[model samples]
Target: MYLDDPNRKLLEIDTDTRQGPVIFRWLTLGMEYLIGVILVALIVSVSCNVVGRALFNNSLPWADELARMLFVWLVFIGAAAAFSRYEHIAVDALVRRLPLRIAHMLYLLQHLIITGLMVVMIWGGYQVLSRSSGRSAIMDVPLSFISLSLVLCVIFIAVVSIWRMWVSLNVIRHPEREH
Candidate 1:
């Protein structure tokens, strides 16, 4: 049961700064900045590789590996930043119509499921990170470094989900107050 917000286009997610805990705000802001840095690095690496291959007849071997790593980081951190902002798609019409307690109950359940899934992902990512020992063939970068991105993002999402659950509980407790 999910749909894009009506004020938004069919595929768009919210980008506005939401009121949240200080730490969440700080973390989300940091992630957003890091996404920019990773994206710039990815572009530079790919551009260097393309220019070297196209104009010089020689490719930068390390560029390909670096680009791949940066791309993975870009995606994972972007996901975490979006999740923290509550930018993910969801249908809320029914919840809006429901009684406050019932609406919050549904939100609580949704966040519980999200947090549970994130925990499972964290466990799996940790397993993969711990078991892997290989390095990038060209750059010699540890393979586990890339895997850590997923784990870190999942952890951040879980924390945000838990915080959302707390907000839901607050609304459930005080039905008269508009949240």
Candidate 2:
């Protein structure tokens, strides 16, 4: 559960607030660990694929498929994690020109939109998983497994976003309690 020290001392020195939402913090750390695992898997799979094809003259049939699948999972999950850290790509030029209150409102609207989109994605992923049950063939794995990745990423996004929304509301009401 304790993914790493997270250098609490640095956080204390860099910001006024000393604590963060525990679940959001843990989820971000967990996803970071998952990304590391996915990277290692990718490296190993590519290495095996290259070596098998070049040196042994025979490639692993499942390597490419598995790597691609993992890559998809990594991308979606990484995006959710990055969202938690406020690291997702955005065009904030206009927002920067606005007053503080307007900019915060726009940010809230954006988070709400993201939440709705993630909900739709979760529903669509469930439908796809249901329809593809027992019908997918990717290196002998069902497509539902891949579909689950979307569901998981969307769920994480929803939880993290909702938590952020709550914190934002609280901070808006009590400007002294931000973290």
Candidate 2 structure quality by residue, lDDT tens digits, 1-179: 74322211111111124245666677777888899999899989989999999999999988998898889889988887776666656666676666544555565676688789999998998889889867335477887887888898898888766665665555456545434
List candidate 2 stretches off by more than 4 Å: 1-19, 135-138, 174-179
For each candidate, what is the lDDT? 0.81, 0.70
TM-score of each: 0.86, 0.80
Residue 47 in model 1: lDDT: 96
Top-lDDT structure, candidate number: 1
> Model 1 TM-score?
0.86
Q: List the residue pairs that clash in candidate 2.
A: none
Q: How do the residues 98-119 of candidate 1 rate in per-residue lDDT, one tens digit apiece?
A: 7667767887898899999999
**Per-prediction tally of clashes:** 0, 0
Give the 10-residue window scoring lowest on summed lDDT in candidate 2. Answer: 7-16
Clashes of 2: 0
Give the Å error, residue 78, model 2. 0.9
